[model samples]
Target: MITAVVGMAMAASGCSAPGPDPGGATATSPEPGKSISNAGETASWELLNAAEITPESTVLRLGVTRIECASGITGTVLEPEIQCDGEQIVIRTSVETPEPGDYSCPGNNMVPITVHLQSPVGQRQLFDAACLDAETLATAFCVDGGVRWRP
Candidate 1:
């Protein structure tokens, strides 16, 4: 199958919490499977599956509150990191919130984040690093299709 069915609904209701830290850790770069936010409470976010993929890029659409009670879902401190390990492409995403605003309690307005690649993805598998995170994986945003491509 070439299409990945993304969870279209943003979780909210009894799941709204304060943003972890609009500002994340000062570590220059993020690791492969962790959301290193301000050294406070350990907050993690579930990554949306690839909504669109091309030879040169992968696109994800998610709300600011991503999942249940999940906050600080998007900022821009760091761009979504993309890595190709010969066999699979691993993508790691972090929460870098926007200027404080009312994006809605359960910020459910889907926005897009695109990750570009250096080379066209030929056969390398596509994986959402969020799946590697236990806390993030528990969030509803990630379901089946951890691997975006299947033969």
Candidate 2:
């Protein structure tokens, strides 16, 4: 009786956000690009290179790439495939554009891939492999903020 009651209470007390549901629907990643909102004009802009901004500087930008793979046999598991060189990685970026103003990076239209980092175990990760696996390269792109899986 007490066990049953406790079980019911425990189940009721648990309130947690659900994980990604693979069978249900796959959430698509956002596209990379510049979003400009000035006056009544809303324009979508692409990332610019640092050299483009010789005397003019615009937005704050960052890029990150992460590698992910499918794990287990569930067919829904995406795991990090260890590359011959190392772990899987993806490059992404983040640009700082002030609201109500036009912003762009200085130097060139395309941001350089300078800083590279890896992800932790049991989580998504990224690496700097001179050449990525065929599967990874298929969905890689340099978008608004950084490189991401767009395949």
Candidate 3:
């Protein structure tokens, strides 16, 4: 009985499993001038092509793109900037609130916002924006489709 218990424990522990292969294949970086697309729930944008101009920024060639903001979300892009820190690139911009009472919400709140983009690999990549709510003072970048904020 003891031997049987020990055998069962060993089997459960996967003692006979093979370790990961050190010589396994690795992913290659994306080539320049490749087209990519990024879409969100309410809008989609396309990049005609991409070229990594700097370690901190990748210049995305603009193509025919359309953006549609959902109701209750009101703002205008004043200036958009791409900031890269290490392997991550965040697209941030200053937004100007619409004229007073233009949006259903009260008060004019102009906050600089950022959207995190997936590390540009090649010509093909994607980025997503989390939904926003004004009443709770929630920023974009929702977690699991729920309202969330980070200090």
Pick by lDDT: which candidate is best?
1
TM-score of each: 0.47, 0.20, 0.27
Rank the candidate models, highest TM-score first: 1, 3, 2
Global local distance difference test of model 3? 0.26
Give the range where candidate 3 is weakest over 10 consecutive residues by summed lDDT.
Answer: 1-10
Give one digit per residue, the lDDT tens place, for model 2 in 1-151.
Answer: 0000001111121111122322455433323231211122111112223333221222212222222221211111111112211121232223332245343323223222222112121122222221222332343332222321111
lDDT of 3 by residue, 121-143 (tens): 22222222212222211433323
Candidate number of the best TM-score = 1
Candidate 1, residue 21: the lDDT equals 18
Q: Residue pairs in steric clash, candidate 1? A: 15-69, 74-96, 74-97, 75-96, 75-97
Better of 2 and 3 by lDDT: 3
Ranking by lDDT: 1, 3, 2
True-vs-predicted CA distance for residue 46, candidate 1, Å = 10
lDDT values for all models: 0.40, 0.23, 0.26
Error of 1 at 53 (Å): 3.9
